[model samples]
Target chain A: MEGVLSGAIGVLAASGIWLVLRPRTFQVIVGLCLLSYAVNLFIFATGRLVLGAPPIMPRGGFIDPTAYADPLPQALVLTAIVISFATTALFLVVLIASRGLTGTDHVDAQEREP
Target chain B: MTPGPEHLIIAPILIPFFAGALMLIYDERQRSAKLAISLGAVMAMLLVGVELLMRSKGSALTGFNDIGFYLLGDRGAPFGIVLVIDRLSAMMLVLTALLALPALIYAAAGWHRQGQHFHSLFQFLLMGLNGAFLTGDLFNLFVFFEVLLAASYGLLLHGGGQLRVRGGLHYIAINLTGSLLFLVGVSMVYAASGTLNMAHLSLMVPMLPEPQRVMLHAGAAIMGLAFLIKAGIWPLSFWLPTAYMAGAAPVAAMFAIMTKVGVYVLLRLALLIFGAGAGASAGFGAEVLIAGGMATVVFGFLGVLASQGLGRMAAHLVLVSSGTVLAATGFVLAGGPVQILAAALFYLLSSTLATSALFLLIEPMGREEGGIAALLALTADAYGLDEREENRQPEVGLAIPGSLTVLGICFAACLIVLAGLPPLSGFIGKLGLLQALVASGSATGPMAWIFVAILILSGFATLTGLVRVGIQTFWASDGAPPRVLALELAPVVGLIGLLVFLTIKADVTLGYMNDTADALLRPSIYAQGVLGAPRAEDASP
Candidate 1:
C-alpha cells in the first residue's frame, strides 16, 4: 500500500511540474490543481499508513500507545485541501481576467511574435 | 471564562478579523462607514501593540524570562495552537501597526475608492500579518501566510489595469508554487518529528536519530527555499519589481513590509529550531543564505541602476534592504555576535520605512514624460530666449512652490537614508551593522569582508541612482508642481519624521534591539515558556 501510494504521488507531482512549466495559463492552473492534489495525498500519508485504527482515543480508557493512527497529519491535510481549493478558484478567476484583459491565454498574458 | 488583559495577545489578530468581516456587510457606496471602521481597527491595533510592547519590556526588565504564551482554547503546548509573544514579536506588531496606519490613511485619500472592498481586504491583510508574526504552530503559520497572500492578491488586482493583471498573474503563479513547497516541507517535518508545535519541534529535533535528522534537515532546507523566494533573494526575485511597480501606490507601499515577514520567519525559526542547541542541524543553511543574500544585493544594485521609473527603482531598493538583513541573519547563525543581528533589525526598520515613503512619493513625483518635457522647457528657457528676457525672468530668485519644496525635501531625505549617508537612520543602521560585523573577531572571515564590500558598494549604487532620478525630477523639471493632497503628504512626512526620530533615539532603540536579539539567541527559554504553561484545568478556579 505504501509503495503504491508513494508511486502515485511521484507520478502526479511529475506531471504537475511539467504542466505548470507550460506556456498556456489554462495548463498552468490545471497543473497547480494537480500539484495540490499530490501535496494533499502526501500530507495524508505522513501519518504512517495505519489501517483499521481509530484516529482519536475513546474517552476515559486505558490507551495503547500505537493503537490509534496519528490524527494531526489528517487534520493538516484537510486544511491544505481547503486552502489549495480556494487558491485554485482564485487562480482560475485571475486566469480568465488576464485572458480577457490582455486578449491572450499565454502565461505572460501576451503571445510571442514567433 | 471572561477574558482579561492576558488575552490581549490575540487582539492584534482578532481586531482586524472582526473589523474586516464587519466591513463586508456595509455597501460599497458606504465608503465613509468602511473607512471609519478600518481606521478604528488600525488605531485599536496600535494601542494593543503599544500595550504588548510595554508588557514585554517589563518582563525583560523584571528578569521574569517569560515569553508570553496565549494558548488557544486554553489548551497546553504540543496539542493546541498558541500565540507566543516575546520582545521581538511585540516590536513587530507595533511596527506593522505603524506602517499600516499611514498606509491606511494614504489609501483613504483616494486609492481605497479605486476598487471594491479595499477596506475589508486591507483589514484582512493586517490580520494575516499579525497572525503570522504571533503564531507558535507551523501549520498555523502556513495558514496565516496563505491568508496574507490571498488578501494581497485581491489588493494587488484592486485597481486593475492591463499591467496590474499581468503582474498579478505572475505573482499568483509563483506564490502558489511556493505554497505547495511550503506544504511539502511542513508535512515532511511533521512526518519525521510527530509534532508541529514549534517549541515541541525544537525539543524533538535535537533528539532525532540519524535517518530522521536528515529528513528534518531536508524539510527545513525546502522550507527555507520557500521563504527565500518570498524574501526576494536573487534569481527568485525577478517577479518582485514588476509586481510591486504594477500595484497602486498605497498597495505597493504596504508591500514593503511583506518581504520582511519572510525575513522575520527565517530569523525566528533559524534561531529557534536550528540554533546552537539543535545538535547536527545547527547553522544548517547559513552559508547558502550568506552567498544568496550577497548576490541579491549585487542584483538589486544593478536593477536599481537599470530601472528608469521611480516606482521600479523603489521596488529594487526593497530587494537591497532584504538582502542586507538576510546576510546579517546568516552572520548571526554562523556564530557571529548577536549585536550584528540587532543592528540588522534596526536597519530593517529604517529601510522599510524609507522604501514605503518612497513608494508613496512616487505617484506625486509625476510621470517620466513630464520630466522630459520639463527638461526640454528648461533648455529652451536657458538658450532659446533673448539674453535680456532670460535676465529679466529670474532676477527675483526661483520662487519654489510650497509643494515642490516639500517633495524635494522628502525626496532628498529618502536619498540620504537609502544611500547610507549621514544624518539619517539609514546611515546609523549601516554604521552599527558594519561595526558589529567587523568587531566580531571570531566570525570576521573573508566572507564577512566580502559582505561588507557588497553593503558599501550597494549604498553607493543607491546614491547614484536616486541622485540621478532626483535631478531629473527636481532640478531640471520646469512643469507646474504635481498636485499633492494633504492626506497623502502627511503619511510621507510622518514616515520620514519617524526615521528622523529613530536617528535621534538610536541609542535607546539599539538597546532594546540588543536585548531582543539576546533573547532570540536563547531558544531554550522560549521553549520552556511555551511548553511549561499550565493547562486550563490546572490554572482555573
Candidate 2:
C-alpha cells in the first residue's frame, strides 16, 4: 500500500508540474488541481502509510505507537482538501474572467510573439 | 469570573468577524450606517488592542501559560486550538487594528462604494490577520493563512477594474502555490512529530530521532519558503509588485502589514521551534536566511530604482521594508544581540506605518497632477523672476484649490519617514537598528558592513524613486489640481501623525519590543507555558 500510494503521488506531482508549466491558463489550473491532489497524497503518506489499521482509539482509550495509523495527518489532510476545493473554485472563476479579458490562455495576460 | 481578561485575546479576532457577517445583511445604499458600524468595530478593536498591549506589558505576560496561551473554551493543549497573546501577538493585533482604522476610513471616501461588499471584506480581512497572529498551532496557522488570503482576494477584486482582475488572478495563483507548500510542510511536520500544536512541536523537535529530525527540518524549510514568498523575499517575490500596484490604494496600504505577516510568522516560528534550546538544530538555516535576506534587499533597491509608476514604486518600497526586516531578523538569529531584534521590531512598526501612509498618500498626490504642474510652473516662474518679497509662493499655503499644501506636506512626511531621515520615526528606527548592530560588537564583520550598506543604500534608492514620481505627479504635470476630499486627506494625515507619535514615544515601544524579543529567545518558557512540560533547561536556571 505504501509503495502504491507513493508511486501515485510521484506521478501526479510530475504531471502536475508539467501541466502547470504549459502556456494555457486552463492547463495551469488543471495542473494546480493535480498538484494539490499529489500534495494531499504526499501529506497522507507522511503519516507512515497503513494498509489495514484504522486510526480510531481503542475502547480502552489508550494509544499504542506503531499499532494504529496516525490520526493527526488525516485531520490535517481533510482540512487541506476543503480549502483546496474552495481555492480551486475561486481560481476557476478568475481564470474564466482573465481569459475573457485577455483573449489569450497565457498566464501573463499576453500572447507569445514569434 | 467569565474567564477573566484572558478572553480578550479572542475579541480582536471576533469583533471584526461578527461585524463582517452583520454587514453582509445591509444593502449597498446603507452607506452611512455601514460606515459607522465599520468605524465602531475598528475603534472597539483598537481599544481592545490597547488593553491587551497594556496587560501583556504588565506582570501577566510572565511564563507562556499565564501570559499568551489560552485554549479556546479552555480546551486542553496538544488537542484543542489555542490563542496566544504574547507581547508579540498583542503588538501585531494593535498594529493591524491601527492600520485597519485608517485604511477603512480612507476607503469610505468613495472606495467602499466601488464594490458590492467592501465593509464585510475589510472586517473579514481583519479577522484573518488577527487570528493568524493569535493562533498557537501549525494547522490553525494554515487555516488563518487561508482565511486571510481568501479575504485579501475578495478585497483585491472588489473594485472590479481589468487591472485588479488581472492582478487578482496572478495573486491568487501564486498564493495558492504557497498555500499548497504550507499544507505539505505542516503535514510533514505533523507526521514527524505526531502533533500539530506549536508548543507541542517545540517540546518534541529536540527529541526527534536522526531521520525524523531530517524530515522535520525539510518540512520546516519548505514551510519557511512559503512564508518568504508571501513576505516578498527576493526570488519568490516577483508577483508582489505588479499585484500590489494593481490593488486599490487602501487595500494596498493594508497589504503593507500583510507582507509583515510573513515576517511575523518566520520570526515567531523560527525563534519558537528552532531557537537555542533545539539542541542539535539551533540556528539551522541562519546562513541561508541571511544570504537570502541580503539578496532581497538588493533586489528591492533595484526594483525601487527601476519602477516608473507611483503604484509600482510603493509596492517596491514594501519589498524594501520586507528585505530590511528579513535581513535584520537573520542577523539576530545568527547570534546577534537581543537589542537587534528590538530594533528590527521598531523598524517594522515605523516602516509599516510609513508604507501605509505612502500608499494612502499616493491617490491624493496623483489626484492633483494637472493642477500641481501648473502650480509648479507658476512657482518656477516666480523663482526664475527673482521673486520680490511680495511674490513668494507661501512655503505653507492657505486653504485654496484643494489644499496642495496638505498633500505635499503629507507626501514629504512619508518621504522623510520612509527614507529614514532624522527627526521622524523612520530615522529613529534605522538609528536604533544601527545602534543595536554596532553595540552587538559584531559590526567588524564583512557581512555586517554589507548589511549596513544595503540598509543605507536601499533608503537612498527608495527616496530616488519616490522623489522622481513626486516631481512628475505633483510638480511636472500641467493639469488642474485633483480634487482631494477631506475624508481621504484625514486618514493620510492621521497615519503620518501616528508615525510622528511613534517617533516621539520610541522608548516605550522599544521597551515592549525588547520584552517581546526576550520572550522569543527563551522558547523553553513558551513551550513549558503552553504544554506544561518540564523545561528543557530547567536544571540550569
Candidate 3:
C-alpha cells in the first residue's frame, strides 16, 4: 500500500509541476488542482497508513503507533481539499474574465512569437 | 497573572467577521449604511486593540488550549483552537488598526463607491489579519492566510481595470503556490513531532533523532520560503511592487502591513522553536536572511531610481522597509545582541505607518487635475510670444487649486519620515537599531559594518527618490492642483501626527518595545502561559 501510494504521489506531483509551467491559463489552473491533490494525499500519508483499523479512538484509547491510522492528518487533508475546491472555482472565473478582456488564453494575455 | 476578559482577545477577530457578513443585506446603493457598519467595526477594532495592548504586557501568558492559544475557556492547547496575545501580537493588532483606520477612511472618501462589496471585503480582510496574528497553531494560520488572500483578491478587483485584473491573477497564483508549500511544511513538522501546538513543537523539535531532525529542517526551510516570498525578499519580491502599483491606493496602504505579517510569524517561530535552545538547529536560516535582505535593499534602491510613477516609487519603499526589518532580525539570530530585536520592532512600527501614509498621499497628488495639459497650453502660448530658454512661469497665477497647501505639507512630512531624517520617528527608529548594533562592541565585525553601510546607503537612496518626486509633483508641475478631499487628507495628516507623537515620546515607546523584545527572547513565560503550569493558579474560570 505504501509503495503504490508513494509512487502515485511522485507521478502526480511531477505532472502537476509540468503543467503548471505551461503558457496557457486553463492548463495552469488544471495543474494547480492536480498539485493540490498531490499535496492532500501526501498529507494523508503523513499520519501513517493502516488498513482495517478504525481511525476513531477505542473506548480505552491506548493504541500503539503502528496500530490505527492517525486521524488528525485525515482531517487536515479534508479541510485542504475543500479550500482547493473554492480556489479552483475562483481561478476558473478569473480565467474566463482574462480571456474575454485580453482576447487571449495565454497566462500573460499575449500571443507568443513562433 | 490571570488572563483578562475573553472579549478583549477575540473581539478584534470576531467583530469584523460578523459585521462583514451582516453587511450583505444592505444594497450597493445604500452607501451610508455600509459606511456606518464599516466605520463602527473599525472603531471598535481600534478600541479592542488598545485594550489588548494594555493587558498584554507584564501579563503571564495564558491560554486554554493544548493545541492553540484558546486554552483559557477550558480548551487548552492540545485539543482546542487557541488564540494568543503576547506583547508582540498585541502590538501587531494595534498597528493593524492604525493602518486600517486611515486606509478605510480614505476609501470611504471615494474609492469604496468604485466597485461592489468594498465594505464587506475590507472587513473580512481585517478579520483574517487579526485571526492570523492571534492564532497559535500551524493549521489555523493556514486558514487565516487563505481568508486574507481571498478578501484581498476581491478588494484588488474592486476598482476594476485590465491592469488590476492581471495583477489579481499573478497575486493569486503566487500565494496559492506559497500556500501549498506552507501545507507541506506544516505536515512535515507534524509528522516529525506528534503535535501542531507551537510550544509543544518547540519542545519536541530539539530532541528528534538525526534523520527525523533532517526532515524537520527541510520542512522549516520550505516554510520559510513561503514566508520570505510573502515578506518581499529579493528575487521572490517581483510580484510585490506590481501588486502595490496596480492596487487602488487604499488597498495598497493596508497591504503595507501584510509583508510584516510574514516577518512577524518568522520572528515568533524563530525565537520559540529555533533559538539558542534548539541546540544543533540554532540560527538555522539567519545567514540566508541576512544575504537575501541585503540584496532586497539594493534592488529597492535601484527600483526607486528607475521609477517614473509615484505608485511605483511607493512600492519600492515597501520593499526597502521589509529588507531593513529582515536584516535587523537576522543580526540577532546570527549572534548579535538581543537588544537588536527591540530596535527592529521600533523600526517596524515607524516604517509601517510612514509607508501607509505615503501610499495614501499618492491618491491625492497623482490626480491629473488638468494641471499638465494646462501647463502644456501655457508653454505653447509662451513659445508663440517668443522663443527663448527658461521662459516658463513658476506659478501661472492659476489660483493654485484646492487643498494644495495641506496636501503639500502632508507629502513633505511623509518624505521626511521615509527618508529617515531627524526630528521624526523614522530617524529615532533607525538610531535605536544603530545604537544597539554598535553598543554590542561588535562594530569591528564585518557583519555589523556591512549592515551599517547598507543602512546609511538605503536611507540616502530613499531621500533622493522622495525629494525628486516631491519637487516634480508639488513644485515643478504646472497642472491644476488635484482637489484633495478632507476625508482623504485628514487621515494622512492624522497618521503623520501619530508619528510625530511617537518621536516626541520615544523614551516611553522604546522602553515598551524593549520589554516586549525581552519577553519574546525568553520563551519560558510563553510556555508556562500556554501549558497552564500546575504550580501556578488557573488564569481564569
Which consecutive 10 residues in model 1 chain B have the weakest lDDT in total?
B390-399
Error in Å for residue A20 of model 3? 1.7
The total of clashing pairs for model 1 equals 0
Q: List candidate 3 segments past 4 Å from native.
A: A61-65, B1-4, B59-69, B369-402, B441-444, B533-541
Task: Report the C-alpha displacement of residue A77, candidate 1, in angstroms.
Answer: 0.6
TM-score of each: 0.94, 0.92, 0.91
Q: How much does each candidate deviate at the interface, measured as C-alpha RMSD after superposition?
A: 0.6, 1.1, 0.8
lDDT digits (tens) for residues B473-522 of candidate 1: 89899977765667777889999999999999999899888988888898
Local error of candidate 2 at residue B449 (angstroms): 1.2
Q: Considering every candidate listed, which one attains the maximal lDDT?
A: 1
Task: Give each model's whole-structure lDDT.
Answer: 0.88, 0.82, 0.81
Deviation of model 1 at B249, angstroms = 0.6
TM-score of chain B as predicted in candidate 1: 0.93
What is residue B39's positional error in candidate 3, in angstroms? 0.9
TM, chain A, every candidate? 0.96, 0.89, 0.92
lDDT of 3 by residue, B1-541 (tens): 5544654678888899999998988987787899999989999999988877877754334321121245544565666677778888888999999898888888877667666788999999999999889988888888898898888888876666567677878888888888888989999888887788777777777788988889888888888888898899998999988888878889999999999989988888878878767778887888888888878888998888889877899999999889988887777777778778888898899999999999998867877755323433433432242322223433222223458888888888887777788989888888877888787655226777777778888889888988898898889989777766678788898999999999999998888888877777766657667665232235433
Tens digits of per-residue lDDT for model 2, B48-103: 99888877775653542235566775567788888777788889999998899899
Per residue, candidate 1 scores C-alpha lDDT tens digits across A16-105 of 999999999999998999999999999999888988998989889688969899888889999999999998899898888888777899
Give candidate 2 regions above 4 Å deviation: A59-65, B1-3, B60-66, B368-402, B533-541
**Candidate 3, A14: how far from true, in Å?**
1.6
DockQ of each: 0.82, 0.70, 0.64
